[model samples]
Target chain A: MTDRRTIYLDNSATTQVHPEVIDTIQPYLSEKYGNPSSIYHKGREAKEAVEDARKKVADLINAEPEEIIFTGSGTEGNNMALKGIAFANKNRGKHIITTKIEHKSILNSAGWLERNGFDVTYLNVDENGTIDIEQLKKEIRSDTILVSVMFANNEVGTIQPIEEIKDILKNKNIYLHTDAVQTAGKFDLDVKELGIDLLTLSGHKMHATKGIGALYIKKGTKIEPFLHGGGQERNLRSGTENVPEIVGMGKAAEIAKKDLEKNRIHLKKLEKKLKEDIFRKIPELILNGHPEKRLPGNLNISFKYIEGESVVLMLDEKDICVSTGSACTSNSLKPSYVLTAMKKDPVFMHGSIRFSIGAFNTEEDIDTITKTLPEIIKSLRAISPLYNKD
Target chain B: MYSKKVMDHFKNPRNTGEIEDADGIGEVGNPICGDIMKITIKVKDDRIEDIKFKTFGCAAAIATSSMITEIAKGKTLEEAKEISKKDVSCALDGLPPIKEHCSNLASEGLRKAIDDYLMKKKD
Candidate 1:
């Protein structure tokens, strides 16, 4: 280590665990390692810790503790919600509705449901990544039993109209599930007010350790258990509890609830300064996602005539970590499907870079990025044959 | 993931620029696929005396381009054309499986430069 500070702006991928959360989880790891399901005194202590963590998570989301089910990760929570709901309510209906821009967890689970004889209606989004409410209402058929949408997009940070979607489905028999993994700790989440019956959240995205997540199922929502064994978590998910991580997640959630507004304001300021500096210095830059409706910390932009992967590598050299929409970083050889869905041109898709800020970011960090980013883009664009100096 | 040699070349790419007085030039890839390379060669006496490349691609693509130029310089046109995709990738130690396609751009760029040379000679 050269004692150089690393600027990590990839919060959408995962966040660094907070020290407070680490302190909260210390006792649970070594001293209180007993399983929550056991009946002994140690087990009782573990169970109390798990319940307390659950209560904290519930309080953050404004839900009953009974409504939350702990899972292995956000992906698992999404799978449980989509597959469990699809299987449990198959008799009542076989159709589902979701947007084209949901996280892969929900989309892949929806694909699995399709293979099992369920019809899924994928609603399209506009240029800003907001789904069409009129189209969503038109697509809901008599056989539609569930509607799934994301609270906010992970790639572009475009927030969906969760409250509007839920209100539209209020009178219907359909159940509404929103994957709130990206939006959970960043904003206020009242399930009743949002009209969301089911929601998913990941620990690592909100300053907690990985491998621990939760799904909120409102009372009266019918869902079958995806995993069957040991009958833990209301028989919905069965596994030995991850005590330390759960405690960490609970602590993270509590801190997030208290610091949501402050973090939001801080990130917004960082984003504004970074964007203004970048736009002033660089030309042919296009911003992605909804302007005002996006996450406070997200700053996605496309630098034309240069590859995003190249920009990412160059930025990495400076110890500033960021992610891109380039196919080189992704499994597929095509540009980001989220950007593609927004009808972005191929050049913009290939050149898109996402700077997902977080609570830890400071104005000086923004200055460091703005100071280094323009030169990186300028140098790459200089060598880019497609770019014209004019 | 990349090999140490790939990282080395990516960190310090050689012969990167446009030879405005070059005898031949070849460009491959488009912005759509997210990788593009333009090679400019200064050939003299049927020998590639100088070669430069400008690439807009991933770490692998840029490294492979740099490696191709290093392999092509001071070689006869026929010898430079014979440089294979495996040769460029092997020069960089090796590329990840997903990035193997980037090497094709490297060799193709050299061959295209040679082709451009022959075509302009015929004209």
Candidate 2:
């Protein structure tokens, strides 16, 4: 399995770290290793590198450098944004609004807040996985202090209406936070233009190494600190900085911003070709997510009457990496909540496969998937008791 | 995660496809739960002459289905019914703990096939 040519299509899960990012972070891990909080020359160098990375990450999302707070991962960023705000604004209100299709980080954070006596309203999504603006209007309350939604869905690739939701919350006192973990490098994240107050980003999703993420908090936003350690990240998240991973993320963010257009085009081309080829080859398949307003690199489809985990395993044998929303693949034995929120049938949810392309994927990779997937589906469907050939 | 024997059985499933004149047919599980096993048996002289399975599931389910067919093919109807879910799993070395329920489908389908054969004998 290790010797075969690996075709990695699970980019949305996490991307392969870019070679440039690796090179940029090399010195920080070795000779330049110094605590950012120290007063020595080495410390100053580390501090400068950390600030530079912050500026780069901020620039990627069009936010001020002072607004970015580094955390352990995107999950941490989301926890900081949700719990931090919920606690900081407890005097103002205890009400929070979020969509049902948000990533588990946001949803689970909101759930924690609810358990801690905050009121949370989970808005439902339409069939295409977009939240309803009219429903948001109805759900808004005077005490609603925050409305957190994801920029895009990770499982199905459905991009949400962040700008529209921002527009609705503009005049209101409620702050808006968008979890952009899936959208950071793939789309233009203009926080200012979108009127977003807070946003979450993960490094690994954008070709940087894991274990580093950033949260952009607009100036003057009331948010409690995540950690109460030695003051770092403006005391929002306190701890010794992960210098190398931060530096790598900065380089990754810079590269992502610079090559956004080219990467988008390349990814879209691969996605379109793969979608067309797979649809042509396989019948009785339903493409999940919004058909047009989806991520450029995401292609989620459900092969009817077959379980997704089986297809994933069969594809693995061919050295093709993919993820499935099937219950059998999950620890809790429940299919994807994202798909369930979209009101997809249980059968479709069990059969869903997400093939997320990346900057590294090529037309040949797409061709291999299109060629291999149909045969896998055919074999699995042949054994499926529910599949009836017409 | 599957054992090597489980992978082998999944890759080369024994006695797959429908028997044209299967004396007894049994289906367990459903598409909603993501694992379904259908077993067909040819019974003669109170023994299973042939047994086949078709499954819609993950690796464990298919492997267990294949394993049950191999375990019960030449056994008497009562002996086949005695073959438990654990027996199917043991034949395949072992299944992931999370996938232990998958083996239940194979044993249940086999027992149902026996019951179906007995029901038809009365008719």
Candidate 3:
């Protein structure tokens, strides 16, 4: 932010495609662009590539290759997991449970289910943004067939207790589904250990191209296909496979696994440095998330008397990219629902900003952003008549 | 955070804290929105004599509170009631697109204070 170079701190929105991932998928996109369903030699090659990618992605999540279902994105994967399970197992139960702080994709899907015909319970989150397991237990009904909670929140980056959720629903025969888009590449993902019957992950969140995602269904978990066509993914997904994007996603997962430990440590360093500097330079700034149980790359802060959007704009002037909220909803005048659900005060909500780091970010980038931020805050506070030091 | 203009107001906001035994008081916005402001006014002969505020949230909230008090000082209740969000924003040279609501919160707080004053007289 101090230099002429721009620093990007919004990786939670979507990561840039790693050079290796882009290179690996080039041959499939141009030279070997054959329909995976085609019986010809190139087509068979393309089909085999998709399968190889599938196996790699499965390995990344510790799931069987046969259990994976390809989809358009994380939203589609979420819809399929919720809607498919809701409609298929209707007779077994009409109750579904999710948290109030889930991504809009999951919430919207839940809304659709409620609109058509289904009972849904939205559990509340604590001040720190973690849901209570006991409340979840209270909400679970006899006919509760599905419990779909997210693995991690995109905004606050509070890692949910997915393992505990798995344990809670273990004896009840309720299916546990998690939207792990924010956690797949950044954290260890073991479906069997977590007891997730259905899991969703997006390619773009982990350095793969956008518009490609995967849904992990444990063996013997029957979910009706959300989209029907040529029965491409073992009749579970009917459209022709997205060969290039699928391969890219698989490669991204493999790369993430290979460097996950290193990346985590690096991001943790960045976040630590950021917090130390922000608190040191700014007056009355508060970090908003669980101290230990948070994503390493996510740093959500509440400035005492400044608007998050003005901060973003000020930083943007220095070519430092960050988020007042989600990039998807940055333009919206409404404050983040995640913070609102956390029960943050209105003034604090308007003043909060999220800075998500990524693989490409460097120590210098963090330093520059840290240096540039206090000045911006100081300036906004100066003109901000709302700021009352007295 | 903000430019110099914003920082000045945040660091040294005018008419800060609260005015006890005031003629009128107004509280607007809610915690759900993450910005809340309470404006207290001391008026004599329908003319605002003094103003103070206590706010709990962000720069815009603090700044808006500061600006409203500064704007309302010495002005008649009618003049202060006519103060719009645009006037506050104009005083501060405009805000970021997403922060327009902060200005609105300020206007609402000021209007609410006048309403509280008039309603008390009726009672």
Candidate 3 lDDT tens digits, A173-228: 89999999988768889898888899999999999999999999998986888667
Query: Which docking band does candidate 1 fall into?
Result: medium
Q: lDDT by residue for model 1 over A1-390, one digit each (tens)?
A: 112389988888888889899899999878889999989999999999999999999998999999999989999999988989999999999999998888888889999999999999899999999999999989988889999999998888899998888788888999999999988777899998888889999999999998999999999999999678998888888878899999999999999999988888888898999899899988898999999899888888989888787788888889998999522237666889899899999888888899988888777878888899888888877777777683
**Model 1 TM-score on chain A:** 0.97
Candidate order by decreasing TM-score: 2, 1, 3
* Candidate 3 CA-lDDT value: 0.84
Q: What's the TM-score of every candidate structure?
A: 0.97, 0.98, 0.81
**DockQ of candidate model 3:** 0.19
lDDT of 1 by residue, B2-104 (tens): 8999988886889988898889999999877888999999999999999999998778888999999999999999899999999998888889999999999
lDDT of 2 by residue, A35-154 (tens): 989999999999999999999999999999999988899999999999999999999999999999877788889889889999999999999988988999999999999999898888
User: Where does model 3 sit among the CAPRI classes?
Assistant: incorrect
The superposed Cα distance between candidate 3 and the true structure at residue B98, in angstroms, equals: 8.2
Per model, kept true contacts as a fraction are: 0.70, 0.74, 0.26
On TM-score, who's better, 2 or 3?
2
Clashing pairs in 2: none
TM-score of chain B of 2: 0.98
* Residue A335, model 1: Cα distance from true site in angstroms: 0.6
What is each model's TM-score for chain A?
A: 0.97, 0.97, 0.97
Against the true two-chain complex, what DockQ does each candidate achieve?
0.69, 0.77, 0.19
